[model samples]
Every structure is written in structure tokens, then in C-alpha cells.
Target: MTLRHAVLAALLDGDMSGYQLAKTFDVSVSNYWHALPQQLYGELTKLEKEGLITGRVVIQQGRPNKRLFSLADPGTETLTQFITEPSRPSFIRDDLLVKVRACEVGGHAELIEQLEERAVQARAKITLFDKLLRELRGGTDEETYLASNSRIGPYLTGLRGRAFETETLLWCEQSARVLRLRIGSKPANG
Candidate 1:
């Protein structure tokens, strides 16, 4: 999917300044789609020019003016159409995966280190996603929140993010363990 679609979908929540959009993407959208702040700013300009998103300048004392953006009619229509289109299947293109595939040739130590590092990263994200999900649910249990909340898209995506990280942590640990075993070495920290 294009960044256009991601930006449009993000604006679905409400009007947001470019900075706010960037923060939102960093916390939530980064789960499914990744974009740098500069990329988001550029796409915002393009979307505004194309009339897919509406932007209004907000003046503030002691600060530069900021443009707040919201989804226009065309933007909503674009997102709707995008939703109806078949999504291309997602695939892994991770460099770590490639290295693991070739591990038999050499570099078991490096590969194991990389895998353990990835596991740590995944654990961090899982903790973050857990906190985010709790905040999104707002003291409600997941079932109740899902049933009662109208704006559950973010929560749903956060759930997916947590699950993804959890799986990543598991896979990384498993891969590391297998490599260590093959090399007749004890697992890291054990």
C-alpha cells in the first residue's frame, strides 16, 4: 500500500498537525506501515495539493504556524476504494532471515548475536505495545472495549502489533537456541 493510503487512514481519527501525524505513526501506524517524519511531511503536501486532504494553517504565538490536516471527501473516497482492493501478500525481506538461511556456511557467532539482539528488540516493542493497548482500552477490558468503542481501528492494529512482536521474540529466541545447539554451545545467559 502507498503512504498516501496510510496518511489518509491516519487522518481518519481526527484533524492533526504534521507533527501530530508523525507521532501517531511512530506509536501506532509504524506497526503496519513505516514512514519517516520528512516522508510524512512530503506526502502531506502532495495529498493537500491533490485535494485528498485539507490543510489549514494554525497560528500560535511564540511558535511557527503549523498546518493541521484532515481527510477530505476525496481522501475518504480514496481510502474506501483502497479498502476494496485486494492487498498484496506481505512477505519477509529481513536481512537477518537471509543471514540465517546461509548460516551453515559460517558466522554462527555473528548470526546468534544478531538473533539475540533482534529478540531483545522484539521484547521491547511487545512491552511498548502492551502499554499502548492498555492506554487505548482506557480501563476497559479488551472484550468490553471492542464491543463498546466506535474507534477501535487503532486498538485493533495495536493488538496486531503486539502479536507480531510476541511472535518475533519467540522466533528469534528459538532460532538462536537452534544455532547454539548446532554449534555445541550453551544458550546465551544459560
Candidate 2:
């Protein structure tokens, strides 16, 4: 998807400054997609010029003036069109996977180490996803927003993120076990 769509979908929750959008991505959307703050600022400008998003400058005492942005009608239309269109087939282009395949004949140990490190990263992200899911579940003392967002794209995206991370953690553990077996080490669990 284009950065335009990413930014627009992000703004679907409501208006936000660029800083707020960056933080939102870090907390929610950073798992499947990523954009630098500079990229976000640039995209916001382009989106505004295209009439997809509009921003209002807000003054703050301790910080630079922030431009709070929200979707215009055109932005919503664009997002609707983008979402309704059929998605392209997914493809894998992971350089690390390719590297591991090539190195399998030379020294699987290094590949094992790389994959193990990836496991750590994936596990950490899974913890974040779990937190997001719990947050999605809402609170007894506070209102939950995700229920209201059931029809929104991020609602579905959150499910997909959970599934993907679960598969990643499973694959990591299994791959590590298989590599250990190859090296004449007992399975980590066995």
C-alpha cells in the first residue's frame, strides 16, 4: 500500500499531530508497516496538497507549533476505494531468509544464531501485540475504543498482526529445535 493510504488509515481514528501519528504507529501499526517521522511529515504535506488530508496549526507553550491533521472527504473516499480493491498476492522478499538458505551448506550455526536473534525480536513484538489485544478488549473502569472500531480496517489488521506474530514465534522455536538436532545437540525441550 502507498504511504498515503497508511497515513490516511492512521488518521481514521481521529485528528492528530505528526508527533501523535508517529506515536500511534509505534504503539499500534508499527508491527506490519513502518514509516519514519520525516517520511510521515512529508506524506502529510503531499496528502494535504492532494486534498486527502487537512491540517490546522495549534500553538503550544513548550513546543513547536503542531499541525493537527484529519481526513477530508476526499481522503475518506480514497481510503474506501483503496480498501475495497482486491489486494495483490503476498510475496516474500526477506534477505535474512535468503541468506540463511545460502549459508545452510557452509555453516548452519551462524544461521541458527541469526534466527535465534530474530526469535527474540519476534517474541518481544508478540508481547506488544498481546498488550494491544488486551487494550482492545477494553476496561471495566474506562471506555474501550476498539469495540467502536470493529468495522475499521485496523480492527482487522490487529487480528492479522496477532496471527502473524503467533506463527513467527512458532516457526522460530521449531527451527531452532531442528537446527539443534542437526548439530547433535538434544532438542531444547527434549
Candidate 3:
């Protein structure tokens, strides 16, 4: 899907300034859609020009005036159309998988380090997701949250993120194990 669609869908929550949108994207939309803040700003302007979004300038005391953006009716219609239409297949272009695949063939010191870093980052994200889930469910207890499903979105997304992190950690651990074994079996000169 186009970045425009992602921006429009995000606006569905409510009007927000560019800065707020950036933060929201990092927390909520990062799982399925990834875009730089600069790209978001560019898309906002383009959407405004296309009459898909409207921005209202707000006066500020210290910093520059902020423009709060909201999805226009046309934008909502466009998003509905986009969602209904068959989506294009997702493309996979990831570095971590490639590094893991090559871990045993060559020097894996850097790759292993990077994998460790990714695992850390993934755990951090899972923690954040869990916090959001707790807030959504209104409690820390799993049974309580399960019984009350008022906030289903974050709960479901959090579970998905947690599962993804677990998978990533497992992959990293297995890669490290295999690489160490290979290193131990191979001769120093070989």
C-alpha cells in the first residue's frame, strides 16, 4: 500500500500535529508501516494539495506554529476504496534474515553483534507493546484483560508483537549457537 494510505488511516484516530503524528506512528503504526518523519511531512503536504487532507494552523508561543492535520471526506473515501481493493503482495527486503543465513559461511562477529542488538530492540518494543496492552485492558492481570475486551486493538497487536519478538530472539539464539559450533569445528587456518 502507498504511504498516503497509511497516513490517511492514521488520521482516522483524530486530528494531530506533525510532531504528534510522528510519535503516534512510532508507537502504533511501526509494526505494519514504517516511514521517516520527513516522509510523513512530505506526504502530509502532498495530501493537502490533493484535497485528501486539511491542515489548520495553530499559533504557538515559543516554537513555530503547528498545523494540525485531519483526513478530509475524500481522503476517508479513498482509504475505504483502498482497503476494499485487493492488496498487492508484500515484498520482503530485510537485512537480519540475510545476515542469519550467512552466519556460518564467513566472519559472523559483526552479524552476531547486530543480531544481539536487534533482539534487544525487539524486546524493548515488546515491553512497550505490553504496557500499551495493559493500559488498554485496564489491568496487569491477563485473565482480567481477557475477560474484558474493551480495547481489542492494542491487545491483539501487543500479542502479535510479543510473538514476533519471541521468534526473533529464538532465531538470534539459534544463529549464535550454530555459528559457535561451526567456529569450534573449523581449523584456525581453514
List the pairs of residues colliding in candidate 2.
none
Model 3, C-alpha of 10: deviation from truth (Å): 0.9
**How does each model score on lDDT?**
0.93, 0.79, 0.79
Task: Estimate candidate 3's RMSD in Å.
Answer: 4.4
Off-target runs (Cα >4 Å) in candidate 1 are none
Error of 2 at 115 (Å): 1.2
> For each candidate, what TM-score against the reference?
0.95, 0.86, 0.82
Q: Which stretches of candidate 3 lie over 4 Å from their true place?
A: 139-158, 185-190
lDDT of each residue in 45-137, candidate 3, tens digit only:
999999999999999999999899999999999998997999888665788888777665776766666766776787788788777777766
lDDT of 3 at 5: 89
Of candidate 2, the 10-residue stretch with the lowest lDDT total is 140-149
lDDT tens digits by residue: candidate 2, 1-190: 8888889999988999999999988877876678899999999999999999999999989988888999999999998999899998877667677775675676677667777777787778778777766665556221345445454466567777878777877877777777777786654334
The residue-by-residue lDDT of candidate 1 on 34-91, one tens digit each, is: 9999999999999999999999999999999988999999999999999999999988
What's the ranking of the predictions by lDDT, best on top?
1, 3, 2
Per-residue error (Å), model 2, residue 159: 1.6
